[model samples]
Target: MQTRTYNHVDYLWDDTKAASLENDEVALFLYRSNILGSDLRITNYGGGNTSCKTIEKDPLSNKEVEVMWVKGSGGDIGTLTRQGIAGLYTERLRNLKNVYRGLEHEDEMVGLFNHCLFDLDSKAPSIDTPLHGLLPFKHIDHLHPDALIAIAATKNSKKITREIWGDTMGWVPWQRPGFDLGLQLEKCLKENPGIRGIVLESHGLFTWGDSSYECYLNSLEVIEIASEYIEGHVKKNGKVFGGQKLESLPSGKRIEQAAKLAPILRGLCSSENNMIGHFTDEERVLEFINSNDLEKLAPLGTSCPDHFLRTKIKPLVLSLDKEESLDNFNATVQILQPQFEDYRNDYKEYYEGCKHSNSPAVRDPNPVVIIYPGVGMFTFAKNKQTARVASEFYINAINVMRGAEAISTYVALPRQEAFDIEYWLLEEAKLQRMPKEKPLSRKIAIITGAAGGIGKAIAEKLVAEGANVVMTDVNQEALKETTKSMGKDEAIQTICDVTNTTSIEKMFDLSCLNFGGVDVVIHSAGLAISKPLEETTMTDWQLLQDVLVKGQFLLAQFGSDIMKKQGLGGNMVNIASKNGLVAGPNNVGYGTAKAAQLHMTRLLAAELGADKIRVNTVNPDGVIVGSKIWEGEWAEGRAKAYGVSVDELPSHYAKRNLLNEIILPEDVANAVFSLVAILDKSTGNTINVDGGMANAFVR
Candidate 1:
């Protein structure tokens, strides 16, 4: 059960600015819509619609005419701008009651909406234009609030709605939305002149008033009544629903489980060209998954119809136990591997059942939301942001089902109706308008030693190119600040000690959870230890081997596993040293470890070629220009070995190369991006970013 008092707070609204000699009607409309959109409790992402009727002068006609400005299709209400709402002549749209009384083609209805537009270049109006056009009030607000739908979808809910709002609220039975539904609302108002709002069974609530603010307030008040009724009547705590007590996971373990499960789920759903991330894990989510009735209720279709386009009618359910049992999760993963194929097959069957001869092309049959016991639940999409959007709507749907069970059974539009909306031409057009993805857009990249230098530059490059990135460093604070500057939306920062197997595996796991699967890995993590054989201590030799030799093995091993499971070729870029090829004086330990890395890269290339995974390395010489690696005593020591001042050491190295220009981190990043993102024909090669060190060049 849920209890929320609808407070009529005008958020982000500036009345002083609105009143200062401008179009107050449109201003007030946008202001109110933003306030509602800003609250996910009322509407989410692109769900819901708002409209206001005003008399404005038609420039060509030279006469003031009634206009209905409504939220256009495919734009979010939270960020609705002036260009987002479409303006149409109210009389022209309403007059369609005569011509379109029985007009059945929704495509034609959409065309008619554009035809009646007061401004031809204006954005397209919402499909619900007919409903708003026929309403008598000057302003109308229609929100798909969870609480409102919870009450509306319950048994005898219409009676309860009348008790709550008395004659001020009306009830409309479920009907396919078109001219007929719009006529329903018009008749409701005429029959009950004092009605403040109308609750549509199996749909949502619609409210209207003389002013935008009043209309907004009416919406809030109506939702408040529904929320109170749910709180008072529905069960809230302890052993009431779900049957068994939820087996809760500790916060730490929950993250670990999700990290492990993400790649498995994403791998099952992915392909050579497209990737979908398993990107959700929350405490409440785990509880819902653990419920006994979860499988029964979660897949019954969405209480809010708008969510069908994002979350689909239901989810793919996998069975297991609590999150703490990693062994059970792994075992379940093995079982679910073949089962996922069945889910996709069933999805195709569902599509085949409802699709007509002239219907839109059937989309990929993979379910966007996946539910499993040990893994909780996850939502997937082509990218992280889209996955997050689906996750939000899915969670809302979970709550709707929960509320429905608490009061009465949750009734939703039949599966056929849902398919119609999901495959709508206008809805499909919105997806078509989305910008084409960059080459690496759906790819996930993991960058080691990402706190600074070549690694940071490469991470930034991948992010700019639309690859979802997970950056790792031993320095937690530096990693936090570095990623913070990049923003949280596209990147994830982790503290990974490359020398530790547990740390390395955890880093890969986090990347999978963040971006579905790892498609590219850049291993630039290393320690530079230059010492003569006589002076090199066992500690120094061991440290270099630990960070470079062992680190490369673990990274390639873990990364290639994901790529193999996904059956998609991936890229691995290892950072090596020119010292590995042509040893300089007192560069024993460093050169030995780097030589091992080069050989390992070649070995990986041979072994993983069957899977189409490419392995390559960049051998750089003294290109520490943009990193802090050469800033302190290490710089002085290297300068002393070169018999030059610290300031002259860079030039000394640069002059020895075939090309005299000093190499920068950006230069290394460009070469790395070339091999990983641009090049597709070659692997097992070393591209030197050393400005052409003649002695170290490899054939």
Candidate 2:
């Protein structure tokens, strides 16, 4: 088993000194919180709670009183500020430790807790406040760390906890969180007076110390110990079977794809920042791809609940043949329909057995796990960090499950129990507290000329905003290389000859066959050749028309056809040059073709309107450095025509715009995403993304 000792936690704590706390301590707390928050191991927006207790003088009583400052209920740790912490009276909590028997409701216990508010506007105390209050140590920390939860989630969790932490920690089985869990701990503490910390099975870990740093360190140490124990005893062993060679996929394209797919999965999982991870490890890849039990393994729960938030319940397992793999994946989701219905029925029966009439019904019963045969697993989260944290836990959980299978039959959590936890009121409440995200999850988009600066920027921005994008370019090698820079699963690279009808058709077909369907299409692929009107030839016009005019028509045709069949309204944005709107000197073929594109946009919009298809144009002025037109020979001529050096053109163009800044591809892409994803009422309109160049008669 691989192991590394983290003295950083020790350093993290040593640096903080209550009032004399060094800057390092403050920085460490912030850093740790940010990291943990991002990972969804400790917190989600404002889920888990942390606290620091110190002795303060009571002015009226003239006596030292113990006080605790716990995390407020509603603030996200990702954006947490110092003021977000709430000061609560620790002495009152300590006094309530023995009086656990008759607690009926949580509100009745609130009067027993005290706090000094720094800000009156802050929300109510965290639900975990009582647990933090009851701990004896001065500094208390709690997190739903996936590593710890993975081990706790198993059937033999109590035995495993004993084997791992031995006598230093106490284990509490899954119980409804809040006052009940706190009461259980009170009972445990009465029995084992020396217990340093508590492990809430299938939930999280809690540790406390005399100071914030110590508490943080203890928490890390405990989690690291659990991780090490799992790695040693429960981790999966043996190389992945099959002789497949693992090679690193390129980053840019894959990152773009990951960015695009991340949002879709996030939407499906009903969370944002859902984590997605790709594995090309020969052993792991072969083990997943060649597994005869793909269907059986795909429906398993994630390592922890938060993992479900990011990766969902499964991954889109893939094979060398993407089409077949996607088909298999969709089939897998389809096959789960009956199983999900059965599971829901079982859940309803369980609820009826245990719940009162006043209790709320269970949430959706869809399987969160998805399996892509050759691809790695994805974990859903409210955000990317949460997804990643879940992904890490899943990797570990798979290891443990494999190891347990090796040792004995690997029994999963009981279905009713899994359902209970999945629909737990506390977790559901967390969902309610989280901010809502955009609705374009699982939506696929295809952008041509994506290797160009404008294309790359737009592709990246769209993915970041939660759209799965397939980026295409005429340059095959460039397209592949660019995709390598993005993520592999979420992004796709295709060498598309937009002007060729066959190529365009194949590309669209592949997109549908691989993903579900196309939601947005941004046609940015075009050629620009500036020539005097008298000097321009028919060939020049045809080439321009083939790409700018005919290429767009084909894209619109295929996009509209697919969207119509899918019965969902979709949007298309055409990347037109400002020259399309107003004529420019010596721009004969380029301007005419672009003008044709604008007319096509209107025509397509009018024709496809009945199908709920919206068509729009983003006319950007100025050929900056990254645009395909400006990077090649055209740059030299445009610079000469403007009576300026190539280096000065960007500024000159910017000066012509009202914004006095160079228009970026991201700006154009933002306009396109808005038109496609959000703007339902506006169509057949030309949105000028030009810095103000369209209004400037002279540059």
Candidate 3:
């Protein structure tokens, strides 16, 4: 093999970090894995495995035994920790070959892995464990680097492998990952005594060495060489993806078109269940989507099992006519609906043709990925992270296709083989082992005024129920802090001035871009001004109307548009006040605005029922604790109006109510949650979170 300089991947190893952990082999193995995983070019998220062999004292025998530490199933090497590694008895693993019933019974070996556990508390070992334990080296790295897979996924992969590294690297034909493949690796290494690594056709690369440092270097070297060779060929072979056939829309236009298309696609594809959506116009994605080969190549599917499993068998390609414009979103939807139906029918056919007697039942027939010619890619899944990761994996597949086509004809895994991996009994078992889905697992919510106590509480509650929230507020600082408190993957923050229609549109665009489409809209952004009729100024009245009444209208108008396009039933909760129904002293501007908000909810509920959009009101009173409205002039004015100090207002208002209880932000949140999640059949109604305000009761 030629010794080439590193160009594509970084040599991230630090000698200082390595020397400190020289005494501990497991720590060194983790360090190697972390640095290698830090680069996506080395391995995709949770797509590869690594292992180290160490001598440790046996817990039972009190004697030294060789233990193999490999990455556990469902763990990502990038953020791997000690607890994430599965420690197995190396001797026990080797002895399993004695009972092996060949490739037909390879899955049974995964269940038997528990018996070989060196530590009872260790994580479950992955299927790739045998590939690591059977290897003769002390350290090994198995990665699905794009460059290497580019070579592996070609029609003439073996021929290309030999030309790239000559005899220094070994090659294994495509096979499902199991004990059989592990035996193949051991045999390949035994035959090629001095080779550094072996490239698994249509799979990935396996490299090993006697020490951790040597193994890390071997993996990087193989990836770097393959990257260089592929780039050289791609540079010589000018046109990629048969060259771009459609001109890409400008960036802003692309986002506009994507925002409009996402919810419609999301709605059409979410017939079986609710799905979160993610939109990406990344350069590579646009290049492929705009290319002539997109229809030809995407339908061929992906070569790697990891890639297709996340992205589905193929992406639904959204083709547009020369006369069609995405701005006419309704017309575009007319085209998409039929195309989606055809795709689902084709998927069912694919399942019926390939399913075996014992194969798991057919899964969701909707395509997880959708590609638009002039726009970008839209991916949908049960959650935000899954949708995002699916997009990343498809991008990886795009790169693989690019490189393979540049050097030779790109080839995909056979349909039967892909089907076997997709519906494998073990894969089905793993799916069954997953924890039950949370109530709101696939729901996406957008909360306006989320920086305030009520909005923040609502966000927290929704997220706790497994909803992804796009928390929007005019207050940037508070919004940042509130979004930070939630899981970063579940919540995202954007500054949205609800009074501004453009800002509201942009916020919905962001919601579609981040978490797919909006399923719930919480209209909580408002202000309070307490004064007698004479003292109230035009400014205060106009501001209240704009922020409260108008803001709620625009938010609902835009939000319901997305929900209607999504075709899934949605929820909208308007946080009105008890004052909206009661005639209260020194409250004119705020009271009228609240009444407008309350009535608007009813109007929207009645009008939007045809689309299955539920609109409701949650009325709260004396919510002084942790409320942003209470921090301003509204608290002092209300206190003065009731003849009490600001500090005494909570108890005074509580006593005024029949129940004599102090209402809180959490109370309002609970009301909203109940209406949306529990009161599935109720809409155009009002829920009172006040401490029994009989005077303000809904009539």
Candidate 4:
């Protein structure tokens, strides 16, 4: 590996920095990780730690003191949440280095430490708590950055470090990285007296400062310099292989197979009964299946250790031959059984060898990695997000392994050590301490025509309220572009023609597979046939019914099926026209179809009541910006029919309302969200979001 150099100032002062920090703490954590993770600088999965120290006045001592909010064990920085930061007693952590034989049964000592502390939760402190506690600064960050790791992994790591950081930085050789590593760091700090940071050989880097921002910036700066130096010097002239050409699978068959396979895979993974929708993307499955070099390259693990908890250590690689594929999958599992057994035995041996009275053994060494020849990967996570994280890690790991293979050979961590880390009792305890209820965290939603107008507003609103929204529209480009601005993890986009049974089934199936099950369905996809009754042909009537009436029926039917099976009463909001409730002169087909839709909503609500599926409708009057009915040729026709210009039509409609204000998509979305979130008792109801248009009495 060679070294490259770049200016840290470029990234540090970028405008997005402040915004990334100011958002939810979790978002900030992930954003910082993305910057550093992409650069391979400070942390990789479970290897590094970060903390923000806040000053609190000690009531007894009547003096200002500090508590370090540090990254908890068992959480990945790539997807760290606010709860992942464990608050620790800083004073006690700094004191641990002075004690003799600090290495022996440190897990027991942690309990004692926690007992002595104040305001700390029952969660287990991170193994790096002592390191965090000892830092004099208000903020501290540490990571096993890949650039530094590559250098540390080399034979001349010490020499390389001396050349780069010189006497001001301390260097520690690799040690089993919990309590012992903390003690080693303390000793290094003592010897160096006033060093800025420490670089652990075959591990990572550490940096701290007076504030959280300062510490984060310093770590980024150092890592940037390290990365730049490596890239500049490293002769990465090896062939850069292009991604595999995906063999085209029949889209319809592929989707059907994916839908069929999702539940089985979800059950096998032991996911919560409601979360099957998260794994159901046919496109994603196809992408995984078509990726090149599955047989030779699929078993490599994640870039970081914690990813193993989600994605497992290996994928189930399926073969082209059906019998051979099943045989290979079974054989792989059989081979893995011994490895798992041996891992558990060794973990027990390690725990027994230590023999700490306070230390408890963790969960068993179940196989984290599985392989099948022809089928793509299946990540087993307790929830949908974690599963997705695991999938991404696996994909990245495969790429890394292929790259490593091109350069040299792929070497994984020893099984015993891997098991020790994976089953660390302290780590498991940290996970248990996380809040049990996330309110609406895992709820699944489907928002039709979400590329624009009311659909987009509703989708955005649901997403903000913690629902994972699957957005769809017939305008594929628009759908993709619309969701591009939204966060990728919680939102997905698909091209859907709701009138078509195949499309509706595929969409519903995809939603269930990816998210577990559906909780809410907001249908905003509809067409308006504005021609006179005499001019409205049978074809026009059918088209209107297909999009407006049939679409709602199919969506409600599928949604009810999944919701009933999950036993969680679901909410369905149909977007009907105010014209449907009142007679309109020229909108014969549209009005008639929407009226049927309104009646259908009531009928479905009655039918699905036994299944705990609630159906309702939102009737909005007149034009809203971005609605197809409001834009294009339809608006002009409506304006002409009403004897007004296109611009005056909004006011004409608003004047008929009680509020005398034009209705917005957000207005309608707000009503829908309120209904879905709160109005469980009232189903088979139509809520008019027309700013009092129902009072017009112009019939």
Candidate 5:
């Protein structure tokens, strides 16, 4: 049972790092938590808690007492810091056992945990605090390791555990985690005095030791032995998941299907709240999805409560045949649409059947995880990170299923038990305590020429309001630098040529793959020229039309397809110029292009009205500061035409305007934001960001 070398998981305890901690037990505990949490095979994000009992002086009495430092609620072990750890008086936590009424009042104990806090400023203790606090060990690790859970979730888990560890590891029957479960663990330990750890049936593993190093090694040893045992049976069993029933599509084809399907799923799933999406075609995911047992086992759901909590009670499995192509998007939509509605109905029935009189109102009836045989998996959430992590947890569930089937039949938690955990008041309280979402939360935007001033400003504004953005520009370096400060969850950058159809397609594909689908589109890619008609050539006219007019058309045409497929109303804003409406001297090519852009907005608004897609235009004039167009020949040409130096053009243009005000890129950005997020009722309209341009009046 004491396996020094690990084959399934890494032994990451660095002796030098442990030595550096010296007598600081809390630091050693965090180190153990971080290293164990680093591997998803051991535990997932926010899935486990690690703790150590340390001797600390009581602030009031100035006498030494044992304090239990454990991971706080909503904290991930891998990223846990000192502040994320809750410090509770060990003696006081144990003393609560005497007053424990019964299982009926288990929730009350969570509130009482605050009274036992060694530090009032400590983070809130998780519901699992009692599981760690009641134990007599100096250090404890409660982890949902897929390998251990593989052994734990099977029907014959007790038999398999005995075969693997004999008397070294004890077994506790399935019970919802609470004061009672902690008492069960204590009673199990007392009976099996020789046991070094206990396997919580259908839950996870609990391992401990008197020292931090011993506890870490003990956890690794138990997980390794269980993993090796599972792997042995897995190899002996040959094919997994009752053998694959459907063949996986080629990588290119899979991605193509994912891109097409993600938007539709995202839209349907967003019935309760707008959701961001994540797609994964990881080999393990494809294996499970392609298996014959997928449809049968998927309905049974994940075995671990942590897994089900994130992935939901079950995934919505699509009935897509391997030979079928998602080429006919509408045909595919018609087929899946009814299935989606049925899933909602089924979830509602589950809630109604399992409800207690005081249970919380049913949550979003839509499934968080969706599976397609030939393609892969799609996960939708309020944000990108959650979507991605949900996908990860589902994959963990897959591994558990695979292992369980190899040794024994995989079993999911009972429906009634699952409902209790899902609707627990403590969980509801945690949800209510979360900060309110941002104005544009769960919205995705695609901005063109995002490396430039006006486009970049719009990208920043949308992202700040909680939109995931796909920023596209011809300048690779500028696009990258502009998106450098933005997180991947917020914005991503790619080189795009609005004139090239292939480039436009790839950009949209990237957006679909990264953030589910598009909700907003801002066409700000443009250039300006100030020249007399006699001096302007056909080449100048063609270039302006290609970059400005043609670019916006392609984006709208492509972007509209996705929005329509989603059946979700969307927003499109074209950044035009005051020169479009106002007849100006020495401006012909640029003015005509802007006018074309203005009309295109009107056309789109009228055409996409039935689909609830809003189209509008933001016309800004004389944006001298932070305007890329001003850094070129247009500024010089305009200055010469007005008989002023290039440096004086800003002041000249500002003074020429009725309000004598200069415009910035941000000014134009504000107009676009308003048109997209605020002016919901108005479309086919133009908002002028220019300083009182009388000639540019719409009339």
Candidate 6:
């Protein structure tokens, strides 16, 4: 079991460079903490904490004082800066051990921790600061690593730890993290002076050392030993797969049942005010879900107490037969909704069992993770960031469970302990103190022709405003590049041939699976034909109609269906053209098609208003500023029709407008978003971005 063979890399210390003279302890502490937090296997977004105790000169009295700087509340160690770690007077914090009334509630510990900050410039320290402060060492590292959680969550974890490492590590059974827990840790350390660290049963790992390197190595070495033990156990016992045999497709891919079931799962987690982000599609995740014992194995509890804050104690399990899901959401809701309600009711009863009359009121009873047979596992949360975090921890929890179960059985903390962590004030602060969401935050949007120009511009604006945008275009290569530029976390890309029903349906399905549902649609996809009516071929006219006219019809109808089904009522803005109101010479096809779309906007508004859905049009003129539409032959034809050089055409159009402004695609994009974001009660109306095209004005 003592397999400390993995080489631990010290990424922060540079041999060639001179170390900074100021505050070396705090500097080196952040350096090593960042290295530890950088690896997801060691820690995730906000799952771990690190601390360093040193003597610093107090700015007020200019006197030397013992100080402890730990990762602050809500700070991610991976990106920790000097400001991210709070500097607390170590002696002052320890003094609270006597004055503090063994553990009462109401976020008072958080307040007291805030009061102990050595400097006003420091942020609030973590709740576990007490535990870190009580340890007698220069550096202390606490990591909820997967390997550590694997061994610690086992039934005989304490006995196992004793057998493998002797007294180098002490074991503390589940004690809810607080002042009392800190006192318990102190007592354990005193009783076992030879221990290098302590593994909190059903919790996480703790290690300390006189130097930063010693602490880092101590943690890595001990964790590897535990990892080897589990690895050895797993190699002998083999692995456990869901006992159930999953159906496979002809192509050998597991039957993907997520698209059909996602909407119902999402609706089950929905509330009048919640916008749930749905997550799925990882290979390991899918395989785990396909396992036969999934229903039995998954509900045990969180692998670590900290994980309970996000995933809750257990998830809502959904089972399905192929027949029930064949009809998708329309049929699936009838089966899944009642089960979701039961899950919520059970959670309420579970919370009531621990209701101290002082616990934080129960949050929306919806489970964050929903596990299904064919669909695997999906995470639900109010925003993309939080949902992804939950999914990250949930995936790690599964690995921990598998590792533990491979050795013995995955035993979790008691229900009351799990409830304590879930309701702990520090964790509750994360939920209560969340920053105000953006106007379009948690909303999902779709943009057609999003590869470039106005469609792309609109997508960027909506994404900037906090909507998770799905960008679709006929150009697959361009769509990939577009997705990369927008940051993959919030952008989903797919090819959409708007005129084709199959392609359009696939685009909406992708949106539904990725973000749970769609709340806004901007129909900016279109094509144009510059030839005069006499010069236009029948095929030329038809191709323009297919992309411009038929595309809008499909988008409006399809987008409306999703919104109506969601019953949340959303916004749709059709990017009609100024040519629709005032036809331009040699632009017959483009203008006629755009005109039809403008009319369709009114029709959708009239029809969808009963559901509170709003539909409108943004009529943009001279929005050809940065478009590729002015390239090659298309550019030549447009300039020829205007009797101007290709380079001068934009200037010519600008002069023709009353404001003499060259309208960029972004200008039109702004106009389009204005309709969806600001025009809450106003629809069936057209806002023009034509820079005052007098003749283009509608009566």
Top model by lDDT, which number?
5
Model 1, 1-699: lDDT tens per residue? 112444422244455654662467887888788888887768788888898988989998899999988888777878898899899999989887667636465556777888789866678776788889999789999888877777677667787677777787899987656677898899988998888889888778899889876787678777766766666655454442466445656667767777766776776766323755756667556657777887677768685676667887778887655443544545656776777778777777878998877677778777788886645677788888778888888877766666766766777668888887787666677679878988678888999998888888888888888888999999888888778767565899999998888998888877777777798999998778666789889999999999998988999888887776666779999999887788778778888999999999999999999899999999877786877668776677678788899999888988878878888888888888899888887899998889887888796
TM-score of every model? 0.88, 0.67, 0.97, 0.61, 0.96, 0.91
Over all chains combined, what TM-score does candidate 3 have? Answer: 0.97
What is candidate 5's lDDT per residue for 279-369, written digit by digit as tens?
9999999999998998779999888889989988899998767556667888887888898999999999999999999999999999899
Q: Find the 10 residues in a row with the least total lDDT in model 3.
A: 319-328
The clash count for each model shown is 1, 64, 2, 39, 0, 4
Q: What would you estimate as the lDDT of candidate 1?
A: 0.79
Better of 1 and 3 by lDDT: 3
Q: lDDT: which is higher, 5 or 6? A: 5
Instruction: Please give, for residues 1-699, the per-residue lDDT of candidate 6 as tens digits.
Output: 222457422233343331552348788888778878887777778888999988889988899999998998889988999888899999888888767765565246667887788867786787788889988888999998887887888898998888779988999987777777787889999999979999988788899888776777787877778777877877787666534457423222223356555655666677535565666656667667767767777778686866777788787777665334345456666777788778888999989998776689987888899876555567888787788888888887887887778776788778887887788666776777877888788788999989888888898899888889999988888778777767666888888999899999888888877787788888888766688789888898888788877888888788877776666888889888887888678888777888888898899889989998899999887777666556566667778888999888888889999999999998987877777777688989899898998887877
Compose the digit string of candidate 2's lDDT tens values, residues 1-699. Answer: 113466322223322333453433433454445555664434444446676666666766778887666676656655665667666656666666555445346444554443444234544666677787766666666776645665666668778778777888888877645666777887887777777788776566777776455566677778777656555543454332212334333444333333333223323433222222222223443355445554455456454444444344344443332222222334533543454455446545655665544445654433233333343344433333443344455554454344344333334444455555555555566678666665555567899999877788778877777666788888887777677766644678888988898898768755653454577899988767877778778998899999889889899987776665455667898999888877677787898888898889999889888988889988888857577788655666677767789888898888877778878777887888788767878889888888776452322
lDDT of 4 by residue, 1-699 (tens): 112334532343344565657644434544554455543234444546666666667767888887666666565665565666676557766666555356557666566556435455523566667766655666667776555554544445677677767886778876646666777787888898777788775455777776445556767666666655555543464222224444544555444544544433333333223342344323434444455644454544433354444554445543333122222334534544454456446545645654445455544333333333233445545445665655554544443344334333444444445555565666567667777744456577899889888898888888877778899999988888888767766888898998888888778777755765578999999767677888889999899888888888888877776565455678899999787788877888888898898899989889988877788988887756667667776787688778899988878888878888888888888888877887878899988888776542323
Tell me the TM-score of model 2: 0.67
Model 4: per-residue Cα lDDT at residue 145? 59
Which has the higher lDDT value, candidate number 4 or candidate number 6? 6
**Deviation in Å, model 1, residue 460 alpha carbon:** 1.6
Model 3: residue 682 alpha-carbon error in angstroms: 0.9
lDDT of each: 0.79, 0.62, 0.90, 0.63, 0.91, 0.79
Q: Quantify how close model 6 is to the true structure by its C-alpha RMSD in Å.
A: 3.3
- What are the per-model C-alpha RMSD values against the true structure? 3.9, 7.8, 2.0, 9.1, 2.1, 3.3
| Highest-TM-score candidate | 3
Question: Where does candidate 3 clash, by residue pair?
Answer: 267-566, 277-516
